[model samples]
Target: MRILFFLAFFISITCHGNLIWSKTGHRVTGHIAEKHLTRKAKRAINDLLDGHSLAFASTFADEIKADRSFSKYSAWHYVNYPMDIRYEDSEKSKYGDVVMGIETCKHIISDKNSSREDKVFHLKMLIHLVGDLHQPMHAGKGDDRGGNDIQLQWFDEGTNLHRVWDSNLINSYGMTYYELGDELEESVDKKKKLEIQAGSLYDWVHESHQKAVEVYASVEVGEKLRYQYGYKYNKLLFEQLQKGGFRLAKVLNEIFS
Candidate 1:
């Protein structure tokens, strides 16, 4: 009961209020792209996919089957643990949840007994979780299911804190997934390439979690945001989405290679 109370209270604080929008869904999708490989990575991917044509969900299912530990959780489960804090106030904050996620992925991947498919599952999960870890809200601390409990009026409809960020923000762009991906692909180059490095999953999550902190800090209590803000942030959102996809692809390619 004590733990339940604490969890409930925390949930209210983080989510039941005004906090809205997160990058979880887009990041998850992006991670899907990140883990899909090309060329030599094919064999590893084949073992991972069990002979599927390499679509996103198929790869995800393969990874899940490989890693039994993950069965305790789900594809959308939150990452565990936190990392270094640059700000004292943020020390108690949830900004580094992504770091935890990356580490979790690493742990599963490195286990010798882990099946090829499970390694693939962990890898795919890591890719998606890394994307979630980056979303400022997923790194949320103080409960609120990362602010899912927060209620708000998004575009004149009543919504919760989590839903707005999970899908609504991207939906506002009015672009299909393919269209968004293509537009972002056009912007990619050597510079963007340097932004996402090939490293431990924990490192990637920490990077995003840190950014999540910055995002929450920028908003105010009860501030009603509209189109201008969305437009300004759209590019950033797309970039994250694209980065996740490309990085996912790169990571999977490496493992299979």
Candidate 2:
């Protein structure tokens, strides 16, 4: 029993440390995009997904991590840039970064001769990558492995800077993705939505990289983060998720329209 308990604890710690946005955050992005998608995009997406909603489809990229064959895609979730360099000026990963992954997925889905199976796979990837792109840590500098190495405490529990932004703050609110999606939708008006959706993909990526710099400056290693931390950063969290959703809709609208 003692050995079993220690192994279980070890696995839990290992898994928790690497997770990206809590499932809730990704689903919220998907749900929000669903609301903003044009009629043509909606129909095309439904047909490609066999009627799966964007919220459900949003998780496919993460879920595939369980299969070793998909291991090559692990790097697709984030892009790293040094503080002094723009992504355009930085060295890109040969295995593919978030930006490349998103672009490739778009190209695949937009090709008329692509197989249905290929289109479905890339569409799911597109949804998930867009959400990942908005996660500030996903734009982290390579030195810290996107803040994964910046260990910290979350309400005194062992965690890290990457996990905190990925899920800790959003999960602390105790809202399901659907609930959060509704709340976000209510909070933003059309003008704000348009503003958030503005900018090219590179512009959006640079925005996230800037936010990542702020996130790194907000705390130090071993800091205990709790209510006060959430209070300070929750608004930024919502804005990123909202922007991700809106921008995803814009991308899909352009592709399927």
Candidate 3:
């Protein structure tokens, strides 16, 4: 009884609805985790890239498909949900852990003996992780799993905090990746691009974390979020996606450069 009480207490204090999102996001990203290329691995990627167009070389397709197939898993399906952990007290929450895991995977993908299968796995994982890491809730330090459990109405449809940010916010913009990509590519100055391209995993995590803080400061969950509100959020989402895709491509090119 004492042990059970202790467990319950712990959960009550530490658990959040958003934990599911991090775990699912992590697992999805793990499947596509890229492998570190040796000369051989580099050669393999080179051969693949040589035959494929850069525009078509994203890991997104494989990732989304995997998410679809694995949607039955609570973890995968829960990407839209937030965990119980908060940034202020629980730095090691699943969401933060997911980021760490991605960083580790990034290194592993570069390992010489990692199999082709593993490389492909990390590639997929990185794709998803890149997306997850940019999510303010994934980087959030609040109790609501970045607001996943915050019950709210999204334009008259019932929704939770996390879901609002995960897809709704992005979808509200009505802009496609191609359109956003062109805008981003044109807007980013050469120096800014170099700065973005030059950073390490730590840099990425920190940047996301900072943005997460900004996002949380801007809004509260449970508030009525309509198309206008959604539109505001979508702009941020577009930038994040654009940054994610560009960084992903940069990482791949560097690996195979």
Candidate 4:
């Protein structure tokens, strides 16, 4: 039992270091996107992934962090820009960002000259980066390293603004990805679904950047966030997840169908 406890503690500490839309959150995005995939997109994806579900494959980008060779991909997960300027107007990162990542993935996957292995690799990355793109903190200010530097407490436990937005509330809510996804997916009316799926990649990135501005204002350094913070932002969180799903489906459909 002591050995098991040690393993769990080690894992908890290791996982807390990630700056991502937690594994379950990514799975939730993948699940919702699965429900709305076009038949052609589904068929194409089945071929590419060898019958794997998007939920099963969505964590590829984050999972690769464990490997030293994947270091180049680190910057592809998030982007930084000032709140007041448009992304086009802002200075860009030399290492690449979510928008560039999405474009590269699409180009590779859609390239008939590309190899099967390359398509599979980039398709998984595309799914994950799309999910990442919606986690407002991933589109955060450069100075804060996308909220990873803003230290704070999450209900008396030590955490940062980035981790809080990444996994704190969703994990504390304690539902499996499938369970939360079913609940959020059912809440969508047809018209709302259409609206969510209507935006372009450029448009979606800016939308998330705008949300990042608000998320940054939600708390301050050394502040303790608890139930009230959850109550206030949970709705916004759900909205972003829903948008990520619908938009992912839209992106995939445009590519494969």
Once fitted onto the true fold, the runs of candidate 2 whose alpha carbons sit more than 4 angstroms away are 1-19
lDDT of 1 by residue, 147-251 (tens): 555656666776654455556678777766556655666666757665664555545555556655555554454455568657776665665666566666765
Encode model 4's per-residue lDDT on 151-177: one tens digit a residue.
999987999988988899899889999
Model 4: residues >4 Å from true position, as ranges? Answer: 1-16
Which sections of candidate 3 miss by over 4 Å?
1-96
True lDDT of residue 112, candidate 3 = 77
lDDT (10s digit) by residue, model 3, range 125-172: 555556566666666554555566677787888776666666566555
TM-score of 3: 0.64
- Return the candidate ranking by TM-score, descending: 2, 4, 1, 3
> In candidate 2, which residue pairs get closer than 3 Å at backbone N, Cα or C atoms, i.e. clash?
none
- Per-candidate TM-score against the hidden true structure: 0.66, 0.94, 0.64, 0.93
User: Which residue runs does candidate 1 get wrong by more than 4 Å?
Assistant: 1-38, 50-55, 58-71, 74-76, 79-113, 198-202, 221-223
Model 3, CA-based lDDT: 0.52
Question: How large is the C-alpha RMSD of every model relative to the true structure?
Answer: 7.6, 3.2, 9.8, 3.3
lDDT score of residue 139 within candidate 2: 94
